[model samples]
Target: MDSLCPLTDAVIGDFAREDAAQLYTLVGRGARSHLKVLRNGLEISEMAVSDLPGNPNAVWTVKKNIEDQYDSYIIVSFVNATLALTIGDTVEEASDSGFLPTTPTLGCSMIGDDSLVQIYSEGIRHIRADKRINEWKAPPRRQIVRCAVNRRQVAVALSGGELVYFELDLNGTLNEFTERKLFNADIACMTFSEISEGELNSRFLALGTVDNAVRIISLDPNDMLMPLSTQNLPCPPESILLIDTPNDDGKGVAAVHLNIGLQNGCLFRNTVDNVTGAIMDTRTRYLGTRPVKLFKVQVQGRSAILCTSSRSWLLYHFQRRFHLTPLSYANLEYAASFCSNQCAEGVVAISASTLRIIAAEKLGVAFNVQSFEHRLTPRRIAVHPTKPCLVAIETDHAAYTEVTKTIKRNQMANDVEAMATDETEAELAREIAMNLREKKLDERVFGAPRAARGKWASAISLISATTGEKLTYFELPQDENAKCLALVQFSKHPDAVMVLVGCGVNEPLNPNTVTPEEAANRPVRGCVYTFHLSPTGDRFDFLHRTETPLPVGAIHDFRGMALVGFGRFLRMYDIGQKKLLAKCENKKKRYRERERKRKASES
Candidate 1:
């Protein structure tokens, strides 16, 4: 019962160091809250506009996302502070209107002593959360391509591997600044870490790429110019992460996960050392099995519990201390979610269509079986350092209460009820008209923003729900799994960064605004899933990227569990968390009835 994860509002960062129970998650736009979290099964707080100094324009900058993890309940994102979300323990927004970012919003999953948390975005000194907040200037030109912040400094990795590092003051002001040329490689992701006791002096960057290579570079405040690592791998790293382990250095270990095959498999054992980016030993191999799509699990000491694309559980261990380990196939068949030692009751996160805490106990000598489930399936799961036994829980709280189908169907009738008494005067009529219109501020746009309601091998599209305009389109890249592309806006703005993701055609598009038909026929437009979006106030077209496919079977306005399946029967999915929350079978009678209704409607 796996759900299409793209639609789930997952908080991907880490928990607080003192306590792993502090969870940070990403929610929908236009809501009164963005982050919904609870501690000890009690509602703690929801991140709202009260946390920032300003609200972003409803016309633009709506979908806020936590791109990556940094530090204590830390995250890096391009959020519209105007979001009606939480403002931590002691923070306030500039005004009542939701907008303005005050500080880091989410956390990294790894915990322990001396762990580093960082995030990157262009910010401006402005009134935020009532207390003059540094409004991160949402750039219409370069929408935060890459950013890395650590104990010593903050770095930004642009599209062309251009890196910028900044040292901040106590008041979060940039003090020292420097730039470097890290890679000619299309920089897919970048991270900064201080693997040594002297992080301020000894720091390095781990960069992942679609070109089947991971590059590690040295960071020196004096001669901080280029990378230090010289190793190259056959598999391109999709995510190069620096995490805390029960190992030495407290500096932790690095995991570079990538999609290693053409159409069949994934290489899960790509772990590296934090200090030296070279391949570590004792790598684990989970051969043949099946192909996995998306996987999220934590590494606890020598024990590695994994949930693959097959949605099965496999716990691996090795005698030697190295990156690789021998695979331990789970005699257990049903896989609920991922396994982690961080939970309160030795529970691992289990996901079907919904996410839940499934407790695990030693079934036999080398086998472990899970027990009961938790109260709620965490959209994002994490355990606290202070309370490793007590897990942090955030209810699958929706931005807004789910609107009933019957209520929505009767909106037109419920709304224009007083039409007969409306005035003819322009001002009076305008006022009346405004009162009758549905508030646009609360609309949930972009279930599938850039694409239309159709199926294909792959596609690209550009759509602006605000303007009801879907401009761009294309197909999947020949190289599946992972993709790296920049919109080749020919004879146009050189600064424009296009997330060019079309099928096969790597060629550029010529400058011409012909009819939609003409543009469609242009060889450049083949399966283009390009969405031309720019940060408000600027006039440069920016590219959009989606880690997973958008909602396929449901409409944009839908807020119910979509039973997404591969065969004739689909599994029930929890749309909010984005992970398959539970397994639900479609009632034969109900499904047949639905089909019958559709057939009658056509008649």
Candidate 2:
């Protein structure tokens, strides 16, 4: 991916490869105008256009034969000029660049006989291979927004909400055939359908407008630019396609199906009558979370519509039913368009920087996996109460080392301070330090050695629900390892949601020195931590911490109170007051019986 040469536009044509079409991309702008040729995702050649006077806007390629071999003539239109280059296989075969002066060029297309049609802000220009230029200006004050051309017909949309149709003659001249004025809405995108057999020109024009509606216009010679049918959409349409459906009798075309892509990541489909143009059997399906752009491509020797959004999806027919499936093999992001050229049974996708060609043997394999990398192993997860986010607790290999070190350090420091004043304290300090050393050796002999213990670092991450992107993260204290998480709202602050985390301390035990009764009498240590959500919803702000004598294994919100599990007991606390409300033994049957008797007495 070249940031210096960002891809602006691309076109596919049957240039030099007889087996597959080649891709030509226009990159850079103004003084940095350049062209790159690609086939099957490999760049074959690139040419810089320094002689051109303006920034390149679009590119078009036409195939011609020279010396009985096929050659491609590439034309790049700029703001005020056009550059033409002829090439065979490489840049070495490119002819001297030819320059044709013109008005500011918005777009250009090949219209047969080696003639090119260039559209400008005001009108159209017909430039021939002989360097002859013919001009046809539209009515005054009309500015062209978009233009689509076929073999013999052209459709130009204006900024002032008018669509003007044109007919091309054998002499390379454009004649204004008909025009229609849309009252209040401007056309966003428009395209001419493929020419059918026995028909000289394309028979229909599909227009998507800013008014959130799709209008199908008849382009037949009898009723040119006539509005056949219009369907309202939930959102503004981004792209539209017209596909001809076969008649039930196996004769000719029966109805034209319209596939519209909307701004809200949805595909709208319906069938239009070939004769009456009435729309029916409307349906819509969500493809992604971003705006959808539809493209026609050939997949597995069959026609399919590629919907490019957050993820690319292929819509095709299988077993007499239309199936919309995502392309599992190709993971494309920010894709502008796709074509079934240069790769066998695959697609060529153009994104912001590179052209990716994917060969998909099996189209939809149900592989939509997202992965997030973390240095520590995740132990617990909790979902946000009101937002589409998650809180995950992760810990390193030495999950308990931090707690043991903190306790040892504090005990040693306190004993040393008191030893200077009393001989008894000095004796206690030595005994405590010796006990710590013994515990360390026991851990090494029973489990991992001290050297194998990693530095303690526990962390929690906030993750997005939709895109799986990490939003924010915070590290826990050295003495704590996260055990459980919950989103709680206290009684005093019922409107505010807070994240609650329960943590436990880790310490080594020596079975050789301690009896079962001594082990059972050992104190369990833990803490409960709380945090508030930031205004932006991306970060967690530390609020308060509550220490517990027993290891906290679980936490839950019960009627605006925090129900915390501490080893064999359950305690309820009023978070706002920082006071314990109730305590109960870990016996469900006894608790339920007491609750039932209390309710009976109250009744």
Which one wins on lDDT? Answer: 2
Clashes of each: 102, 0
Alpha carbon lDDT of each predicted model: 0.33, 0.62
Model 2: per-residue lDDT, tens digit, 374-485?
4345555666656656666665445434455557666766666566656876777767766654445432225432322323446677765444566887777664667788
Report the Cα lDDT for residue 300, model 1.
37
Per-residue C-alpha lDDT of model 1 across residues 198-217, encoded as one tens digit per residue: 34333566666556566666
What RMSD, rounded to one decimal, does every model reach? Answer: 26.1, 15.1
Model 2 poorest 10 in a row by lDDT: 41-50
The residue ranges of model 1 lying beyond 4 angstroms of the native Cα positions read: 1-132, 135-140, 194-202, 244-265, 268-603
